[model samples]
Target: MAPNRGRPKNLYQFHYGCQLFPTETRTQKQLRLALQARTQAETGPTLRRNLNRSNRSVKAAEEPTPSHPQTGTEQHDVLGFNEGPSLWEDTEEILNEEDEVSRARLRSLHQEMIEQQRHRNWKDVMACLFPAYLHFKKLTSNWTVPNPFLNLSSEVCACPVEAYKERDVDLIDLMVAAIDVYQSLKSKERKLTQEVTSTDQQDVLAQQSCPACFGVSIPNNDSTEPASEPADNHQVFICLDGNFQHRHHERASKNYIGIENQTLFVPSQDIESSNSEIREAELAKRVTKKAKDRCAEQHKAADDRRNASTWKGCDDTGLFGCCCRHDSVIAFCNIHKTGEGRGLPMSIIKRLLNSINPNVQVGVLYDIGCTLGKFFKARGLLTNHLLRLKFATAVFHSYVHDWPCQLQFNPRYNNGWGLTDGEGLERLWSYLLPLVSPLRYATRNHRISAINHRSLFHNTLGIENIVLTLKRKFIHALKTKKESEGIVHQFLQDQNPHERGQKYTVEFFRAQWQKQRKFEIEISQTNREKKAEQAQFYKRGEALKSLVETLMDSLAASPQSDPAQSLSLIQQMQELQKLQDEEAAKLGSLFVVEPGAERD
Candidate 1:
């Protein structure tokens, strides 16, 4: 706690009897206890085998030191053949594609590639140290931390075998490469298992998609819900949004290897193509300079300022991600040196459409769905695919749009959205928040690979919990439907019948919605002066309402206040009264006399 010394106060408390062996630090003690617990949790036979070996899985309790590192001779070397599943025969290789090769050599080659990549860029700066845990626990069955490959330079720090060639972090990065390979092989094995039980043809969408959202293969014991329904359940709803937190600083890393073009991401070239299209439209005078509404203009200006200025030193501005309704990542693309353009989401939608079955309905919900829908329809882009797709703004975000936009594009007002709020990708961004800082300095390939890995893990978890997710969603929808129907019924009952004995039925409200939509669309197109006048009226009305609410809040904020705070509150009320008087003057002497004026 001392400022100048800035060291733990308890550092000198521990005393050792002798220095024959290096004493365990806090980290080592914790790790040893963790490993010892794991050893105890194992079966009795495995525990006996581990106990027989002097250096076994629980070796962290007593790591070999720099003075006398552990060594293996042919006489004492631990050797065994752990047979891999026959399905590994078809799994893809890291860099090698040659078949019928030794698995050990393939592993060696993979490790070599990981080392080369590590040394080339992240040798010192960004190498991942040996993490506290591995990605997959299955690998831990045969894993040992105190292996000969790792050198315990001290109780605290670790180095690799080649005499300080790599730090513990580098060893961790090396291990990630092995994990990546292991994960791929396990996925292949899983897909083979699915093949035995599944009847339908398999593809990326069919395999990776959530069973609840798309359709389950196995029967739901509940029995009422359909499992053998059409692919994508007749409609595919996706959430699209931009996140600037996952940007990369240009000065942090330098590599021309280009980002990996994989299933998890849309290629940079494809997104760049959309950007080019936007620029060309502007040049050709096909794009309008006028914004659709004040909200649209404000949103665009804010985006422009954020993307252009906030990340001047960064090459990647952010990311544009698309996720299915069940929060499974469909695809995402990196935004390069620019704010999100119309090109990004449009390109991603085109990509999604091209991937899914053509006949199925596709609903895309984004933050600015109304504006994007207009832009798409005006440009006549994606002509062949547009017929089957519809656009809606996300439920929470729709309020940010003008009333007209909300009426046209908000899922709450529109049909077919079904309680789908379209905020799934926001949850995804929260999942990637931890990667934000590290990825800003990571190599481009590593950044993409890391995101892909995280997304894969998230999707795997989504698949595992999909049935529960569907059950929850169904319950929520049913509850909401009942409450809404009751409220509507009560409202209808409360409405008085007209002189002609005509009731204000649900059909009447539907007709009113249609009429209001038509009037708003017409007014938006033709009445600029009227729109401005109406905006001012709404602004003044909101000000008055806000002033009333503020006064009420301030009155209740401190019912038992002191004299000085009481004086402050009185002055605040006077200021509010003065503003109200000014607003009244703007209303052309609506009040009898000037309010809040001096009595004299």
Candidate 2:
């Protein structure tokens, strides 16, 4: 019998395991065309039906007929052919044609399936089976060879059995080899794809030219400058806002128009002026011509100076000290430069200054707010000439006094203090009175009473209202002092003169005052404690002096003793001195007796 040359059993097998994997071979362009044709065919019939229905009479009058001779011939040939199976001929021609077509379609489908199966097998072997086989070989090679069932190709019947039996190595080494092959293949594919895509893109770009360059034609001229080098600033004038002369006119004019204002001009002679007088006159004219320009330069310079001063003073006194008299005065003026010209109130200025220098002690000699000025004036009446002279000297000595106290007093100078009201005002007054009195006059006398009076006054009557009332009252009282004196006299007369005013002479006054008054009780508890500490300190000093004398006597008497023993004695003396120092510190006194005594 002839050897069976049939397909393998695996090929005929149902493959109930799963369907064959499909391969990606269809071109995107072909699929897209097929989809478009199907959509058009479906829609065309509906469109034609609608057209015929809309014009039924016209369609009936124009009968349909074949346009070409082959159209009718083709129809007749199709109808004349055999339609069914014939017993005599042993074959149905129509059936045979149908079978042939069916066979051709089956053949095409089988080819597609085989290609898909081959691709799937290649991927599975490369990605899954090969890696697994390599891993098994690496682990098993060190031991006795494993069974032949471990051979993946033999089990899958995908690759030759001889290939499966090939010796294995480390999985990583095998994986590296596979990876190198994959990378090479992938690189080639990418290069080809990129070449095709880039070519297509370049063609597209070449076909679509730039509209501007395309619409306008210019003859080639060697005289023309290269496009990369733009026209000089004088030649090219571009008005971004669009209302201006063209490029040619712009080059001729050599001056670009500015918004609202025309291009400024300076005569060549004015620019070339060499004489000092001419230069000075030109400079003055330039400044006078544009006040804004001159003012801006001056303002910028002033700001730079102020900033330099601020940096210089930050280490010594902080930024507040850098403020100039003009700044304070301007702040005080309350003049709204940019808006409505309304001056700020004097009280507002005071609040502003206090806010700016809340922690610093500022003298009141410089302009302070009106209320503070009046308060200072009132205190000045009580102050003696000697105190005033000292105050004047102190003000001269320290430049802190030169600062504009009045302008600094404004709340506007302080960050975020302008909106403070009654409670905030009271707190500010309390804080400022103490700060001001300490630094202002340099007087030995305590201004506690004066500070308290001002604080209480501001607290009870608002600062502005108090100044207003005082002004009104002072004028009225000056005009009518006799009436005020009478009221005062009546009150004074009502009290007994002996009880109202008691006079004491020196010697007898001291005896009576000392005897009648409880002086000891008047002494502070802290003072009593200090006195006790002094007594204890004296006792400790006596004890320490005795101990030191004994140590010195011992050392002098034992001069022949071992030097080491003598040194040890001296160390003990030093330790005692240290103990004395620690004790003295507890009592708030230095242990040293002499002012410049050397401590050992």
Candidate 3:
């Protein structure tokens, strides 16, 4: 297209011969052209040329580049398509891809195992079996190998350790192999079933349907599917406490070595900040006072020695000290530790709660349950976990607590705890004493393992006993019910002819309620009378104070210069003391006893 002669001269033109006229005045057109020229100068051919100088510099900003440039050999490290094919590398990649697929399949199988309740520790069991499977496969290379399900235990026992060693297989390796094998078997079975079902459907479809009707009725095969297991509502009771087993450790006194060393104290998280600070200040003050007293004693002794022997060379020796060895353990479920033992039990409790099913009712019995409850309430710790928790003290421990504490933490009052449940930890300790001697001689790991194994064995036996007891109870209940039903029926038939006893009547219940109300009123009246008497009773402190004041007054009034007057004053003070002792005896007669303070 040709430019129009009638258009403004201040217009733009393209290389394709397209022309555009300016819409603004001459000054605006000039300014627009100037701006365009400046922009072009800033980001035009020169800028593009600069960026092109190093393709790497621009690309490097967008992506990572190695610090040291690669040589030809380094670049060729990874096999290229142009190079000869590497069978081993290709095989490795294929195997890795297969392994990933197998792992996913195995996870599903493991979940199935757990859901079926076939095994609690399916992975560990499989780990122990996989090496045997491998050995069997090697031996039966020319022949067909039987499935592990036939006799997995026997195979495991027969398989040599050498087979595992040859393949550099460990327990973990065995576990992985087992998973892969299970996954493969499952996939193969699934594929075969799918093929069979498909072929059967095709064959049925190929045959002519009933001429009169349109559909063929096939019997449903899904009726035999196993019923799903119910959710576990088994209640678990766990007791936690510190058991101080005195095992000698070489490094028990490592932190308590020298005279200048401060007390081997660990700041506790359970203690309030103010209380901790006060304790620290008190300890420091006591240490300072002790040091002063020691210095005074030393100086006095030195002076005495100098006076006695007419001193020689000055001796500058100060006090020397060594450390003491005594270790204390705080344990829960036979798992013990020696350290700052405050929060260790709390951590173990938290872990135990988390691992169990959320619906399980957990009753924790501790010796200091009341104190722990107060601490937990104050701090709002374990708030999320208290939903199904029942906190109680052990039966024996509860006897030592105050009335209010017993009311809150006594297991007798707690409906969640079963008979003898709270005593489990105590029973475990009794069993543990026999095995604990080994801990003194064994390594730390060995001690832990021994305790754990013994605990496990005890738990297993306890479970068996519980199961047997329940079974026996069920049988006894059935037999007793059957035996009593006939006699009860005959008795009821006989009683039907006569009126029921007055004990079952509404009047009897009304009378009982009235009697209870009267008893409660009487108790309240007694409590009120006791409280009033208590208010009139003189406190021991007040009685002592009065006696002291009277003696002070008598002493002040006496004339100190005259011996007769002083003697009389002394006799008067003695008489006052005698009177005070008699008054104290009277006050003690009305002493209110604190609960649990009575001697056993």
Q: Pick the lDDT winner.
A: 1
Which 10 successive residues of model 2 have the least lDDT summed?
236-245
- Sorted on TM-score, best first, the list reads 1, 3, 2
lDDT of 3: 0.45
**Candidate 3 lDDT by residue in tens digits, 57-100:** 76767866699976685445464533667533422122355555
Residue pairs with colliding backbones in model 1 are 128-169, 129-169
**Model 2 over residues 484-533: C-alpha lDDT tens digits?**
66765565445344444633334544465455445554666577667777
RMSD of each: 21.6, 39.5, 29.7
- All candidates' TM-scores? 0.58, 0.14, 0.35
For model 3, what is the error of residue 75's alpha carbon versus the real structure, in angstroms, after optimal superposition? 62
Question: What TM-score does model 1 achieve against the real structure?
Answer: 0.58
Rank order by lDDT, top first?
1, 3, 2
- Candidate 3: regions farther than 4 A off: 1-234, 246-248, 251-342, 471-600
lDDT of each: 0.68, 0.35, 0.45
